[model samples]
Target chain A: MNNKLKQLDEQAVQYIAVGAAVLGTGGGGDPHIGKLMALEAIRKYGPVRVLSPEELADDDLVIPLSMIGAPTVMNEKIPSVQQMAMPLDLIEKELGRKVTAIMPIEVGGGNSLVPVLAAAERGIPILDADAMGRAFPESQMVTFYLDGIDCSPITMADERGNGVLMHAIDGIWEERMARAITIQMGGSASICDYPVSGAQAKQSAIPHTLSLAYDIGKTLFESKDSKQNPIEALLEQLHGYALFQGKAVDIRRRTEGGFTKGEAVFEGTDAYRDRMMRLFFQNEFLLATEEGKSLAVTPDLISLLDQDTGMPITTENLKYGARVVAVGFPCDPKWRAPKGLDTVGPQYFGYDVPYVPIEELAGGKGEKL
Target chain B: MNNKLKQLDEQAVQYIAVGAAVLGTGGGGDPHIGKLMALEAIRKYGPVRVLSPEELADDDLVIPLSMIGAPTVMNEKIPSVQQMAMPLDLIEKELGRKVTAIMPIEVGGGNSLVPVLAAAERGIPILDADAMGRAFPESQMVTFYLDGIDCSPITMADERGNGVLMHAIDGIWEERMARAITIQMGGSASICDYPVSGAQAKQSAIPHTLSLAYDIGKTLFESKDSKQNPIEALLEQLHGYALFQGKAVDIRRRTEGGFTKGEAVFEGTDAYRDRMMRLFFQNEFLLATEEGKSLAVTPDLISLLDQDTGMPITTENLKYGARVVAVGFPCDPKWRAPKGLDTVGPQYFGYDVPYVPIEELAGGKGEKL
Candidate 1:
């Protein structure tokens, strides 16, 4: 895609929403809610305008906004149009200027579309990029945070129009306070964080992430309908690997410390009948291993999907007795840096394995895509 | 106490600190630490000036500053001079003006002395009044909150020099966010909350609270030294009553939801033999009942003391088999109003009884002194 403005219709929104679920790695939050919001927003206001980062002027204020809280609470609370627009309204007043555009803090499930929902309400455009190519549990585990952009002065508002403005010294403090505030606000709140100049947006944001999610989603749908191998098409689009194919034997899940932590064990079938695969998740899927050996770990994308329909399975929805396939893909190159690993790597999630690209683990090419 | 400027020396600091402990009702924090800090500050700065609320200019900025978090953690953390000063420094930067004076958010235990420590560092006078005459579990449970003062833009700092600034809609939000922030900062932090102009301060703050605390402490010391009845002097000073004198038979304690809740039962002795007194506490001692009859309940002050020595006993230090006495005094008149009672009354603490003045329960005059 060139640096021209684009229009996002209902169809594009659905594709991007579904694709973001795949990248969510099981954590980001349900996409159905975001899809409904996005479609209604597009229909109510015309198709939202999507601008490439290069199209923004140097002095423009680009803010990344999304929902911060337990996905379980978010599911029950549901987003109201007013609640979605609240953070942006407060930010504009605090900054004493109109925001140029809204962007996603992370491209995962509902987060990828929350900015779209807010921007449509404000009659503003949405940016085509995201701060994190995928979602992580904490706010500080993003490229912007790693690159040392100030995450505040940040503003957030709950469903009741109660609001808080925070100026924190670092992104870790931002995540800590934001999580606490979300719980205080009855488990969910909307936030406008990581404000940056248009120039900084171009430098730090993961580029074309919306388009990437859209294409990834579109391909998955087409492959399933055409009776071709959906998993293979997904691997091709992401330049990734087909990690495993199996039937889920047992799934153990628990919500702990505000994140869903679980393990799903799969008995391999097809070409790998005797092997066993294990998947672990904390909000998002964090690790995939075969025979207790490392297959893939974050900050690499590891996702689980229904084997037949190729529907992405969220951490909260992972069920026993379902046939599934696990796919592994390299994350954005920005996530491979030392600082990025310190922020989002498997060790950051308390896993013991050193992070290796899925391509390397798959005995394929061992270079950046 | 007249509306005159006062200078606080080490001796005066000790009196005020001890007096504040009684006002703490039972929470506030350990007064010993506050006493030490106040003495150190007065020595280093050559005594701190304290002003009457009427002496301030209309435009003078008065900030209520205090220590927030678990008193247990605070005791271990042992605040550094820099940590205590950090909140003031950040607030000054946020306010864009030098604060004219520092006042305690609540004149209870250590909270009463924190402002004195900060004021000496900035070479500013301490305010003789406080937002709350005594400490309650939360920041919103203050007279200033009842009088319609916005609780933010508020600033707080942890021991590590990490800082946070929040703009909240009301004191409840302020308390919620500040409590969470304190926990995140490792369970103890310094906060500058409820910034108000001098005129507003006079209208809302409980007047001359420092002197009230000072006199309480001075008399307790004097009565003990003169071998006169300390309990009589204490009751006479506050126009209160000695509800019971007995031997503590049982004491049960636990920390719950950030507040300390406990029950101490004392078997009657002396003139109260064969009767029973029960003391229930949540941070502050909330109630005293004799034979299941409500003798004193918040927002009335209830305190426990060593019967023989007349030394004040904190809720945490209440011991079984120790001879003790229970004292009851009326809270500020502001807290007796319907709105104030609604905010900090016994009902707010989950007690079933309607609040009655200590004097009324004692079968004496019920009118406000």
Candidate 2:
């Protein structure tokens, strides 16, 4: 391995870890585990290049890689390494072709690292981005999906040498089939699917995710020693805005059929005390409401941070009486369109708020609705 | 419409309706509405030829289609006509190829008709087969899945003019994402997914499903008129042996997100009288046991039938004091394979039974294990 390449790999990991933490907002599970996994893969595979969408050839085939199941179960049941490549191998056999690149399905927690590690170990290149700019709970919640991409020739495997391949007519069937197998596989399985042509990959995946992740991660870590406002630093980097400042007052959680669903009630802290906010979660934070009015919905980033440390908190880890700050970041421009709003907007989540641009929702700038 | 086609459609519908009833046994939502939908589609689209597995080309592209959501909601919501084709359209657009054939994902209740109707409407040919000879909840419970296939390029669509295309890293992500989107899309959505190759389809899908459904439906309908035992008639048609006979004494249910999860306590009737059997259901009857020993698990058919009408009872429609016959049918031989069993058999659903072939479990000379 080239020494410079190894150095870049280490530096990239630090950035990804920070960016993943920032992008995770207040949920998407802890980034520590995913960071470690990616780091380990890098150590084993040497340096991985951070490719831009523009770097892809039109005929190149790319697969989106991820871990699907209850995050709670993920903690309890570690995945079998074989399961990780099951989808990739199955698809290759099915297509009778080789995969050219690996892409993360999302840029949050374990997902962000899953593809990176998988690519590194396989000695494959990784598309420096993901489908969703932030995390959402479902497979269909991706830009590629909105762009009408197919997820078939998808494969799922378990550690016990058990595997299932399904060429779903659509993305929904993939979800239905995979969920059953994951539960059977003890609630967590490694997956790599969604073979896409390089053209589709360039058009659909969020662009330049690697560079953004690295920048965000580097800022967060470096700022920690400098006593910088990591959250604010993140906001500037992503051009996001703070949506609320509060303290978690109540949390209710229930795991059903291998999914964790619940809500977090927060009492506003500064400039917002006496007002109440509720954040709902299902593996990922989905909705946020303040004073009984909808504030933010998915497709937009909703990050919850510790008031003091500026550290992010995950949905499962939210505790009562913890001071927190809620921030809203704008998603890719493509997501704000009619189709996008209908998909990840507030209305989609059973809320009535016409999606207010994050710039408008943020305080101090007087960005109007 | 061709007069001959109408008659064939009617006959097919009649057979499918009856087969849906028995195949549903205990938990595939009421197939009536879907039956109507399929009938309408078949009537409009002309007769759908049910091709046997051997008829498919080695290179043909085959896909299975279905609607996934609460049967209760399907009853009221009445899926939009467009939702069925959205995912198919999405996948086709992504693949940049035409699909050669369509197949049923599960040959039970409404789902059985889903692919037939989708094929009729799309004017594509449908294989006379399915992945699971019967129904099981979740997407990963198919023969193809057991064979380590991928479920990606899967598409999910909602009636609210919103559609998501997901190509997740695995089947589990596909399920998780689809479930969340389904809930968000009014607790249910019409889905068309599961794409497979004809060669794999021939090997994976249960063969002769069309004939099986027709025979089962015809037998059940004829038995209603002839005063013969409908359950026995169904068993004979399926070459299936009886598992148990019982009367439901209690049912507990509540809808979470969109799925209806519940339990039914059965007081054995006729030969099974005085012996208690319990069934756990979530959209479909998933597990059953007698005297604390597990009887049937997923990837295998577990059905509850109305003792009088031979009509299948869905978990959402189960009521106390209903006399029902519970039966287990021989699954496709492929499912009996160790790999298939590991992917879907009793053990996959958390049961400890060493996959006693249903033929053996039925203790009969018919349909040898």
Candidate 3:
């Protein structure tokens, strides 16, 4: 994989949108809105420069910019460019320094692209790294938190011009305060948090996740053009497991406490017919289970793809009766550590199941037909 | 009416406590805790200097500091000195300037004295003027808001080291965001907002309120020594109307949405023995009614006083079967203006009653036996 992503143009934004959605695991807000926002920003302000973590100077200030709140609300309420950039402005003002670069807090569909708008507007580079290698529902689920980084001086802005800057003692407090503010800001807000020095970013950040997303997206697009099975091509590229191929039968979703939380039941189709899978989510898909046994649990990635087009389906976009392919990829090795498992594992989300690795659960080569 | 208040000693703190409670109008949290906190701060850090609005230079940076959230919660969860000063520290850090003086946001029981702890600790003068001459429930119900002053750069801190700084577009947004944060900070928090120039303070603040509070408290204390009825002296001093003399028969209060919201029912005594009064409050008493007719409405002040001692009683301390005298005073003339009435009026608190001047409702004399 060529990892030298230098700029985000229209084509690059498209590829990253699809690839980030795959990494998003049915969460991180609707990818369509994020893609449109990023594309519009790139078109208006010219291409945003992509900076790898290694290139950052030791003292350079890097801030992660993203959207916080229910994906359901975000789907209907699209934020303006000013709203997207307000948090960056606030954080810069609070820190009394100009930001060196903007990074996504998570490598999720919308969050991955949200930073591009601010970066382009400010004429700053966008870092090709993220705090969370893959998305999790809460703000505290970032790798920075696991590394014991201080999540203070967090900033947020809403569409109505309300701006907030918080100094939380820890990541948990940041999540609690930011989520409450998000709910008050009409269920969605653009946020800038976990501002780190270049050295801290280099030490704690999950590097090259953006490049990974771009590659994934490109693989799917090329597979489609070549008339190969796109889902199969995706599984092969990521060494992912095909958890299930099913038609969505029932979906129960509700927006509560600034999160889209619910479950969906799918009736297996094709070679996996007669089997049932229940997928649960609190923004991102947290767990996938078949007949009470775990197919994939959080800290790993579980994404739903359009069976034919190989496009990623966000939790907000998945519909009943749609045939989809569920794929599972092992998470970054860091997440397998004790602290990471305790943080985003099944039990942390109140699930009774254990977090068995996707590869182990899939019996090594999970090509279910 | 000697308004030459120079410093806050033990005696001064005692008087302001009682007098502010009277102005607080049965809200503003428990006066006892405020008095204790102020007295302790005075003992530890020496007397806090008092500054009149006229003493401020036009460019002097003045900030009002106070407590936010349900008084019910604050009565139990008393904040530490650091908690009281954290908001000041945060606001200073945000503005990149030291505060010239700290002022009380309102002339209410606990709120009126909360700034003393910070002022004394910082060795800065405490402004004798306040935005609200009498207490109102929400943060936006201030004279500064009425004068169209900006309430941006608001800061808050909880007992647990969580500090928040917000740049709200307006006062209403400040209230919404600050109140939400207050609830998240475990029901109560210390806050600093409406930081203004000394010129703004002189133009918009209710001047010499701390002195007025002291006089009110002194009158009540001296009246007992002079063998005069303290309540009668208080009514004469403030030109206040006695709304009712009754026993607290029932009170239904609940802490909800960062406010102590409820109503107190009083069974009349003495000359008005056959009547009943219902006093409704959201932090401060917004409306007082006798048999469905409005006796008083906000931005008029309605305070409950102990019948024997003539000491002011907070809404939290007004127990069942306690004999009391409910007094109504005219709010500062600023609150009589259209914008002021619109802000703290009975209708604003959803009482469905129109605001009427206390003089008109009391038949001028207001000397009901």
Candidate 4:
């Protein structure tokens, strides 16, 4: 953690990809696809520079760029370099200035690294921060929205060369319009939104998330190298609780309304045999429940990790019969507030469950269910 | 017909509203609402100047502005002046130039006047032409599309102040994206598209359709004042055919896919008593049939008029019990061409009918059923 990253080398991208997947909590698109894209971009364009939010001058314009649509579609349709960079081109043209830095709108398996492709190609430094400390389903579920930042001049591009520039009245409107456009653009699109000033980024964005992802990725990788329990190491590193150890029994996923929506039911195994755990999601896992009790609910993190490799599984990749370890961690404090919970809480996603802190649901930090 | 309209005064707007309704063929939104909006804008500002395509310098930038969505919704959700002008503002900003002239994308009851609201407010001249000689449901059903003109830099605005600027690869893509946005904007939105040079306008645009509308409107009005049969005057003026005189016996309408679509069944009355006629539509009336024989199929024009007044009835305004006269006119020669028919013909609208000229179906000009 002390070794703050300065640039995105191939190794750094590999580590961030794993760490971001864990944070993605079974959404944010597939990590493997993002890692490959980031690697290819880095190999061709050289390493991308990473800057801390504080490093940005107050007047610098920082734009967060990522893919917006159903993760299932994104897994199949890889974006071209032009599609990745077109939003940046449009945003710059709209703002009439060069982007000072690029960053991810959310820290997710795919989104965290999506910006790397653009940053490397543009030769712009990537900010070591993101609007959402962890990935959430909707565009408005970001710290930027929590702080009432204007989500205007949002730009998007599909692989086919169709580009759109939108000025929404607010983040909610941005979500509605952008999602509709994404659906029309073949269910996936690269986007640049919430273009913020460095001052605004420093005030609203979750700081050092890229570095945090790298550290967590390094922990999992190092633990595996040393023949230690990688899942245990990850849980310890994140102060996360093991919600359940189970094998996926059923998963019902459908791509609708521009999102990968569904739920996965797991039959408890090993230490927690003969029980059931259910994880519900709309892109990002929003709630985990067992025996009618809330294990973890959104505004908190819920991740499903492969039991053997300790690698995270996205909602798109989680299949029946996969042995997995479900875990939970406290979300960024900004999300624990009333406004943040109201924006991304379980009820907002149409889940009937109430929002509960991961620690409370787990009966304390690092506890095993 | 000899007088070329140099300006749009209160009287000209009144005439054009009625004339455009005839051209609209029962789509293109309601003329009464358009008349009011155009009148309000003219009274607030001054009479809008009308520029023929020839009057425009070859390099002059002309943009077509109109309302896009289901006429059923447009009749209820009247757009504000800000909404009408926002697309013009956004398009000018996107293109980085001032718009030289404003024209209607389609010469419909509502669309023909929608541009005047912006042209008068911006002090720009209104062009006496439109891309679609008559209104069609989809955005791509324009002469410009048939001419292979690029339809990018399309801009849209909602009453809520949300604005979108899109660069579609083609006219079809523009229709897809713009329609989706219109649906999200509460089923109706003001839009500006097909930014063309005066040279392109002169080549692709249907010239003086506004003047044509004015003449038709004036003929109907004057004939009514002279105690002559207005419908007869209309039929003679346009060299149109009376398909059927009937009373609407059944009307089935639904707003779907960003269009007001359905069919009306009319029981023959007066001269054509004891017969039945069916008219099918998506915004504009595209087909009419009697005993499964095609009376008229699109790329031709079909309209329902009030038998008593000769004022055209919109698809949205047609009632189940109204007495009406269904008429047919040959569409612009451009629409009869292969590309134009392929784009807006009955087959394209899923009618399963071949395109046949109205003159052939009616057996001659000014014929009555």
Native-to-model Cα distance after best TM-score fit, residue A109 in candidate 4, in Å:
1.3
Q: Candidate 1: give the clashing pairs.
A: A27-A283
lDDT of 2 by residue, B106-162 (tens): 877677777766677877777777777777767776777777777867776676555
lDDT of 3 by residue, B88-119 (tens): 98889878899999999998779899999998
User: Higher-TM-score candidate among 1 and 4?
Assistant: 4
- The interface RMSD values of the models, given in order, are 2.5, 9.9, 0.7, 0.5
Q: What is the C-alpha lDDT of each candidate?
A: 0.82, 0.71, 0.91, 0.91
Quality of candidate 2 docking, DockQ: 0.06
Which sequence of candidate numbers ranks them by TM-score, best first?
4, 3, 1, 2
Worst 10 residues of 2 chain A by lDDT: A1-10
Worst 10 residues of 3 chain A by lDDT: A360-369
Cα displacement (angstroms), candidate 3, residue A245, comes to 1.5
**Each model's DockQ?**
0.44, 0.06, 0.84, 0.94
lDDT of 4 by residue, A90-173 (tens): 999999999999999998889999999989998999999998889988899889999999999999999999999999999999
For model 1, what is the error of residue B260's alpha carbon versus the real structure, in angstroms, after optimal superposition? 3.1
Candidate 4 clashes between residue pairs 3 or more apart in a chain or in different chains: A26-A315, B27-B283
TM-score of chain A of each: 0.95, 0.90, 0.98, 0.98
State which candidate has the highest DockQ.
Answer: 4
Winning candidate number (lDDT) = 4
In candidate 1, what are the lDDT values of residues B73-104, reduced to their tens digit? 77778786788787787678767899999998
Query: Residue-wise lDDT of candidate 4 within B133-207, one digit each (tens)?
Result: 888989888888888889989999999999999999999999999999999889999998889999999999999
Angstrom error at residue A312, model 3: 0.7
